[model samples]
Target: MSAAPFTVLIPARLASTRLPGKPLADIAGLPMVVRVARQAAQSAATQVVVAADDARIVQACAAHGVTALLTRTDHASGSDRLAQACDLLALPDEAIVVNVQGDEPLVAPALIDAVAALLRARPEASMGTAAHAIDSWQDFISPHVVKVVLDAQGLAHYFSRAPIPHARDQAEGQAWWQQAPLQRLAPLRHIGLYSYRAGFLRRFPQLAAAPTEQLEQLEQLRALWHGHAIAVHVTQQAPAAGVDTPQDLERVRALLGHG
Candidate 1:
């Protein structure tokens, strides 16, 4: 099969609960949204565009010569915003579309390529995402960290905030639960980045929210609940932190300066 061109869409919105006007927030002298777009441009994607709702965000992208499309402000999720972007860009059904989060200025180019390539290689998959091994018990228990259970084929079985393959015997202080044998079965931490075929991208908003999705507040669960297969590409490296709060922004700034 011929390689299909991929478009990376950075969905940015000014209104953020943790950090208001986050898209325009300055990080190392540049708006956070523009920084993400710049990093995404390093990928082999055919094009990179900022799908935003605010006029200021549109202006910022224009100033940097980055393509920006104004999407509706009512979109409940970034995936929905990306769908509008696909329509505005006139991407075909066979084209690949990546939804790069605007808040993730530290997103790695290689990770973006991995997700896009996964979808390209698996034509039958409606979506593709990345995951890293869970090394620490702290991360495994953190509700903020989403966990994914993958099948033998590397496709996600489920995603949740709670730990899976629950150690029912751990409550009894079983010595075996802390052994290497049990540690070898550690769960994978789900990364938020995602890529999808234009065909599925266009249909995402139409899918009803699944019960698990609503309970966990995870959008990808809706796809799994609907029986759509999501290929999970495991990577050895840890993904960079997404700037969701002031503290996260400070850490990213420090990393960029030190680099």
Candidate 2:
């Protein structure tokens, strides 16, 4: 399938409680955000731009020859920063904008293409994201691993940290997904990458937080609560881990042959 042309927006913040200046953190000698931008650039996206919370981030991107724009530091979330960026870039309402988190330097280009294509394929969906079938019982029950339940049309029914579609039968450590009735229907692990129409991207900040969102600590629920459909593209492979702490950075650096 041909990947529809889209723009990639990476929201980067300098102040990280876990790793200060994370976006500017070095991995294999390049800033982590710069590495993420480079990976996103490999996709079918027409342009890859960083919506940075600080001028230092902009300067870092410029130094590395990457396009970046400075956004308000006070923005409540990364999505808000991207909303302002959509206006600053003058993106058309119908244009596709994929949100690639700044910390995912090892993100796959194919995943980005798959997500952007969803907007073109499913006009009914207001947004697009990827997920993969859960293969481990441990991950299925882990709160850190988000789970998504999809409808017949592949639209998201709900996203939660709980072990959803709970197997009332699978006790102890049995293979719940391998049960005869669920052989082809395993639970899914939601990937964080998201693609949104530029119009919706800009309006996202105005949506009231959903109760589920606050309880689960997931912002995507706000869109679902406000009656927006998020199409889910099921990928076979799980996504790489995103950096949130110094240990994660070290792991990534080691993987990149710099540690």
Candidate 3:
């Protein structure tokens, strides 16, 4: 599907606690951030700009002929950085912007397009994101895998670390998603990709953190708490994970033939 006219914003920071200078970490012959930008460029987005926290990150993008903006280093989150970026670029309130993680070098261009398109099609939604149905019992029950339950209209009801739509009658430690009532209301694993309007993106950080958001440690709940709708697109399969540690970086490198 074709996406509306859109821009991609990639927020990169140098202060990763697990892997310092993470944006500049070498993946193949290019900086990890640059690889992410190149992948986003392949999408329907008219532009792919890095909203970088450090000048070195800005320079790296410039050297690779990618557009980038130097955002505040003290911003609390990626959303905050993106809000500043929207202002820096002078994007209109109605402009759609996709937030692509700088660490997700293997992020799919088609997936990026799908998210932006989803937002454009759902006017009632302030945000758009993707999820994939969970097939494995381990992933279904794992705290590391975020679960999203959708309403009938394909809007997210809630996102959580715990297994949702709980099958009280079913035995524990089994694949609930593959059986009876659970199969009808299958559990979905949320993807990190997001698409937001420039206006909403700018206003997001100002919204008070929700009690549920604080407990789950999920930022998207803030929007839900404030009565903002989030439309979700369910994909058939999950995308590759983002780099958080040395081990994850090595895994991605091997997948990309860089190891």
The most accurate candidate by lDDT is 2
In candidate 1, the residue pairs with backbone N, CA or C atoms under 3 Å apart (3 or more residues apart, or in different chains) clash, namely none
The segments of candidate 1 whose C-alpha lies over 4 angstroms from its true place after superposition are 1-4, 171-178
lDDT of each: 0.88, 0.94, 0.93
Q: Give the local distance difference test score of model 2.
A: 0.94
Looking at model 2, residue 147 earns an lDDT score of: 96
Backbone-clash count (model 3):
0
For model 2, residues 127-219, the per-residue Cα lDDT tens digits are 999999898889988999999999999999999999887878668676578777786679899999999999999899999889989999999
Error of 1 at 235 (Å): 0.6
Candidates ranked by lDDT: 2, 3, 1
Q: Compared with the true structure, what per-residue lDDT tens digits does model 1 show for residues 71-167?
A: 9999988899999898998888888888899999988998998899998777778999999987767777779999999887889999999876578
lDDT-superior candidate, 1 or 3? 3
